[model samples]
Target: MATLLAGMGVVAVTNAEAAAGCKVVYSVPSQWQGGFTGNVAVTNLGDPVSGWRLTWAFPSGQTVTQAWNATVTTSGSQVTATNASYNANIATNGTVSFGFNGSWTGSNTAPTSFALNGVTCTGGTATTTTTTTTTPPPTDDAMAATAAMQPGWNLGNSLDATGSDETSWGNPRVTAALLDNIRAQGFNSIRIPVTWGQHQGPAPGYTIDPAYMARVKEVVDWALADGFYVMVNIHHDSWQWIANMPADRAGVLARYNAAWTQIATTFRDSSPKLVLESVNEPQFSNSSGAAQNAELLHELNTSFHGIVRRSGGANATRLLVLPTLHTSADQARIDELTTTLTALKDPRIIATVHFYGYWPFSVNVAGGTRFDAVAQKDLTDSFDRVHDSLVAKGIPVIIGEYGLLGFDRHTGTIQQGEKLKFFEFLGHYARAKKITTMLWDNGQHFGRTSFQWSDPELFAQIKSSWTTRSGTASSDQVFSARSSAITDKSLTLNLNGTSFLGLRHGTTDLVRGTDYTVTGDQLTITASAITRLSGSRAYGTNATLSARFSQGVPWRINLITHDTPVLQNATGTTSAFAIPTAFRGDQLATMEAKYADGSNAGPHNWTSYKEFDRAFAPNYTTNVTTLTSDFFAEVADGARVTLTFHYWSGAKVTYHVTRTGTSVTGTTS
Candidate 1:
């Protein structure tokens, strides 16, 4: 956007009679990686204003984290800020001021272009200040603990899932085994969303039932014992009372105060690893529009924070999570929540928001399963806004609940692979920004009864992004081999994992530069210096390609191929293997070429391969690639050459091979 020289500021005077005539000065008082704060002073040159809204677009994907002296909201790069009650009026020659905190990726340049009520701003150059060098505020214990919570998971549908009882939600009774499984899955934190409405006594000193409270405590203890940070919140109370319903406002608060007070007091002696979220998503239907609803939520949060602190013991310093209206990521809601919470000056206060961005795509229940660029942008923009609004302000943010809903509700067919990709990216992005994210598990993706996941692939996706372990997408990846294949030049293999860190051949660890090179998810063996086992020949015969990772079990790809090869000299004879239709666009696994005497069988590296591209050609069923191997010494024809194809974790190849002249022919298996 627009940049102003340091210590330089200008005030432009335009035709005062023009209806939209107004001069605005925009400046950045401070900025840091991923966030910045800006000030805008609007001067009325045309006429006095009773109300106003200033709008502008950020050249980069900058988003408003929080604003003061105005109500702020953003759509993509465009920002809209309306006057607060205190700053609504401006007279000709008079000026009003508003400021905001925003976040940006890559660059934090100020927007050079600006508009006031759709009218282009004129005649003012910006002034920049040297980045602040002030020492940051001392982080409280709660803040530090909250910071430790990255990549969280929710015990959804089991505790807070809709129903009269826990089992009513289609999930088995909560057990220690389940909690152990979660902790073992690399999740260091768990958010237990509990619906306490039904478990509490009636009015006039309404009390939470002791039995239900103990049940909650039992589950909580399991989480703590498993070394997981626990966050227990009052969930689904809004459906019963916690809302903007004027008639029930007093009663709702009474019950809310009583429930939190009791729960807080009971866990007052618990370790600091336990956190208390004020309430689940609070619904607002106040007649006073967004402003009033925000005020109502502000009051609710303030009351909740106060009650918890007053509950005593560890409660005073315990981390507390607060949610905005409906726990929404809307810019207006974030602005309201940030403005309200910042005033509390409580270091332990964490702002909670739920992410289900671009409902049609992220949570599409109408059979939509694609997660393309548009969906990615939705996630990027959502995280950016919250970062600018709260995280930049030193307030830790917790994505209380986030997930791509059932891929196809009617049929069991879900775009599981794509969904796993989304999870991987979400966790990766969240970890980078220091934003803690919890996956919403409701006995759908995971089977509580069997204590197994319906899709282990999906579980692996989230596990690979965890921060507790050295493993993550940014550094290392862990996954089982899907398929193995051998080309003439090098060994080609496909994996369920996206990134490559290191590889091994069975027990022998292979070096990166010397052994293999990785591109995206494919790993290609480089040097032929791999030493063979005692029983194997010079090259790996009947060998397996294993990988070493920072976490999880090492993955191995069995390299096998069936095709007759003509014994050629140094120029190795090419053994052609047909690509399967399902793997037309996918990379092939490692392939092995067997010697006619059964003396040796080594991998053949596929140097050149083609991916199926509909744009490149129509009616293309399979993309064929030629594979080569240096293992070809001398072989006899019609000697019953065997080529066994190994598949990836989720890939299956079907093909039959036949020798034609000098080349081997491959057909659909």
Candidate 2:
């Protein structure tokens, strides 16, 4: 045995000859005015070693600020990086790599000499190698494989649920028939999120329950049998324990690695269609800032890559997906993942992120009631960043989960028409960018027990977006005043490159010249036709017209006849106050509350317009608008508040409400 002094650290090498044959590759992949990112790969060409350390002296005054995949320490200009617990062993001809963010002034040069366990490296010199390969070269094209997995769906809130079992969430236990139905509905891929923290044994081993492992494998096998691209990941564990990496780095990494190791070994021989994702929405708790979070996620990703690649069998070449911090599509997050992917130098790697539309619009808050310019821009900006950053550079991207955030409570939170437009635009844009999108379904969009879509029309639009772009209109609703004679209604059509076929009502096709006429992008329905369709001019939706296109799903147009809704005075406790409302034919769009002195009231006081469902919700079934406890909790005691309700038909009704301790009263005055 020989003791090796490695830059303020010492290691015992049982066989000194084992470190004789070694090669080190040092490269700076990116650099800024005063900072840069460095990568180092050390390959052991001699006998296998249980533990090893690589040390080098930087010619310039360079200091490492952050590192991942290894424990790195610097003294003066000397840098020593020791293998992490999981990556300490190196088989004959095996390589271990680590990366760090460092700062330098003036000249930045690569280190020419490297020492492994006190022995000078002779196999190769430390040079700026553009690409570093830590694992066997990939045998398949991940780009092509991911491209074929277009239009995916996630089995959300199921195995990923934090409950005691799969059925712990509202979603029924996954069945073969459900998967078959998904395939039948035109989904080419399935993302199965599984939580392991609740099913794993104590520390050290962190062994996952055998029963849970078998159950997860059963789903993967079923998905592969159906010829669907499958992706499995450690889901909710991101918050359960993985997020505590900053507080317990060792324990967190151990459990995370153990979970993935088990997953990889179980599916090592499965079909190539099965993809392994390191983690779901990787994030860190009590982290200093975004920089530290990025480093922690990088550590997890690199560790996952090494474990899967070395698992043998199909995993050696299996497509592995890595996510940015919180799986966000922000430019900074994308750039971070870009560095990780470039450092890994693995062609079989794929990038993933989640999109739930714009923040305000996603949750139907802050007056983001429509898919307006702001929402559209958010979608375009996110996709553009992902495309330019990763997809354009030969790397593929998967939107692991995409949907409206409000869908969690109820799809009705977002108006049906706006929701349709959102999905339609998202589908078209994702396809145009050549990125795969997997709809996040938590037993909301698709009814688990009924085996049907909660909103079939929305699903149709999503399905249409996969193959081609669909034409939409400026507005889905054509409002007509119930007290006045009907007049011609016109809607500007967004052709989206396809020609408009015509308009239809049920089985009867309306005559193009007399009933409706399309001139350029404008479609006009004649007044005579409106009168005929809307017989008696009944309140609410009189008729629903379908505007068909040459391709894709047709746009729907609802003819609504409404009057100014009337509000009735009421009295109730602070816990629940339901204001009697005569909706007539109008549909509620949003509500606004303010104090007598013009100060905003309700939960979100920043904006006068409260959230659709959170602050106040209108029950069309009951013909009343209910103010929740959350709303009254924020209101001033004994203060009269003015409430303005806006309707989709351009009707705004004003009412007054005063809360006194536990009691409340509403007046139409």
**Which model scores highest in TM-score?**
2
lDDT of 2: 0.84
The local lDDT score (0 to 100) that residue 154 gets in candidate 1 is: 86
TM-score (C-alpha) between model 2 and the true structure: 0.78
Query: RMSD (Cα, Å) of candidate 2?
Result: 25.0
C-alpha lDDT of candidate 1 relative to the true structure: 0.61
Sum up the clashes in candidate 2. 0
Model 1 CA lDDT for position 518: 66
Model 1, position 327, has a per-residue lDDT of 86
Across 1-669, the per-residue lDDT of candidate 2 in tens digits comes to 112222322223446354346777677644444555677888877778667888889889888876765789999999998875445656677787777767778977777778887777767754652211111222388887788788799999999989889998877899876775565455778999998899999988999999989998988877776657889999999988999999999889999899889888999998888899999998888999988898999999999999999999999989999999989999999999999988999999999999999988998887788998999999999999999998999999999999999988998999888888898899989988999999999889887766578897888788778878888988899988988878999999989888887787864678999999989889999998998999888888899898877666778899888888989999998998999988988888888999999999988899998887788899989999999998999999999999999998888999999999999999999
Residue 212 CA error for candidate 2 (Å)? 1.0
TM-score to true structure, per model? 0.52, 0.78
Residue 626 C-alpha lDDT in model 2 = 95
lDDT of 2 at 50: 68
Alpha-carbon runs more than 4 Å astray in model 1: 1-140, 365-368, 407-413, 467-669
